[model samples]
Target: MNREMLIKLWQAHKNDEWPHVETGQEGPLMTLDTVISGCVVYVLDGEEDLDEQRRAIVSDCLAELDTLEIEINDECRSYFGRLREIGTLLLITT
Candidate 1:
């Protein structure tokens, strides 16, 4: 919900990016695809039994990702579609 929580998650992902770096890369080498996908899954599954705070946090993450200029590839597009379907179902049921 807060900036601190979002920063924590981002930092975790940032740390996780190190091992995936290519041999000759200079900066962080992780794909936006992988990072965003992990974030999406974390928001969805991690917030499955959400409290108000968790829902707000997940919503904030989703909003932040929504604002970014991410180039979704075919695989990421498919995951997004699936996430939309799941989100729709949750909305309808709740």
Candidate 2:
């Protein structure tokens, strides 16, 4: 995904403003799954290329989530899987 779009999505998720899900539950404010899925949508909608910096940001965000001990819900896991499939297709075609 374009680094700028990815960063923007990441920032949105970090701020708990992702449009897909409403905020206000308990526990961690954000999760890796949500951030990654948001990034995927941003990437796909923008038709942006996934470069090293974008990948690094994704990796770092995921790592940070892991360190935070946040658990991925089933819905988020499903979203991640779908994003992975779509991302794979985009990679193969581009």
Candidate 3:
């Protein structure tokens, strides 16, 4: 994930502008999940390939995601599961 995108996501999260589930579109949530998943892949593939600064941004983004208050409805279960898995992998590998 690029720094600009992370910053945008962070800003959107801070503004409570994401998680568009109420609109019947889980796009923003999906985007966040994808970005985090990508981070995990990159971290596993080669942590050295990612810029140190970008790694910090990713870490901060994941931390921010950790603070999110998502409802555990059926629609969100898979996403949350993957998020938790990603978080665990990050904790173990990073």
Candidate 4:
């Protein structure tokens, strides 16, 4: 996904303006779950451009997403799963 799109989605979630569940996702909770999980991965990628402190923050964010219920599409699940593996590896290193 585009970096800007991820940022926008993340911002919307933080603002409580969740995506329209009926637009494509399973439902309200799943929408937020998938968005958040994806955002964590985005932030994980961004950490490479950030300083140690910022990277720590990103890793912390990833830490919180470990038990999230990502109820998105199969493609998204596969995509996010790959990112999650990379992100999880980075988290452990941090």
Clash number by candidate, in order: 0, 1, 0, 0
Candidate 3 residue-wise lDDT, 33-85, digit = tens: 66766765565456434556656655665665565535436655545544655
Q: Write one digit per residue (lDDT tens) for candidate 2, span 3-23.
A: 454445444544553333324
lDDT of 1 by residue, 37-76 (tens): 4544565456544445544544554454354315444434
Off by over 4 Å in 1: 1-49, 68-70, 84-94
Report how far off residue 10 is in candidate 2 (Å): 14
Ten-residue region with minimum lDDT total, candidate 3 = 11-20
C-alpha RMSD values across all candidates: 10.8, 8.4, 10.3, 8.9
lDDT of 4 by residue, 1-94 (tens): 4445444544444455333333434453354355445545556566443446645655655554443435454444543444455444434443
- Clash count, predicted structure 1: 0
Candidate 4 least-lDDT 10 residues = 17-26
Best by lDDT: 3
List residue ranges in candidate 4 displaced over 4 A: 1-52, 63-69
As a whole number from 0 to 100, the lDDT of residue 6 in candidate 1 is: 40
Model 1 lowest lDDT segment of ten: 21-30
Supply the TM-score for candidate 4: 0.35
Candidate 3 residue 11 C-alpha distance from true site, Å:
30
Native-to-model Cα distance after best TM-score fit, residue 92 in candidate 3, in Å:
3.9
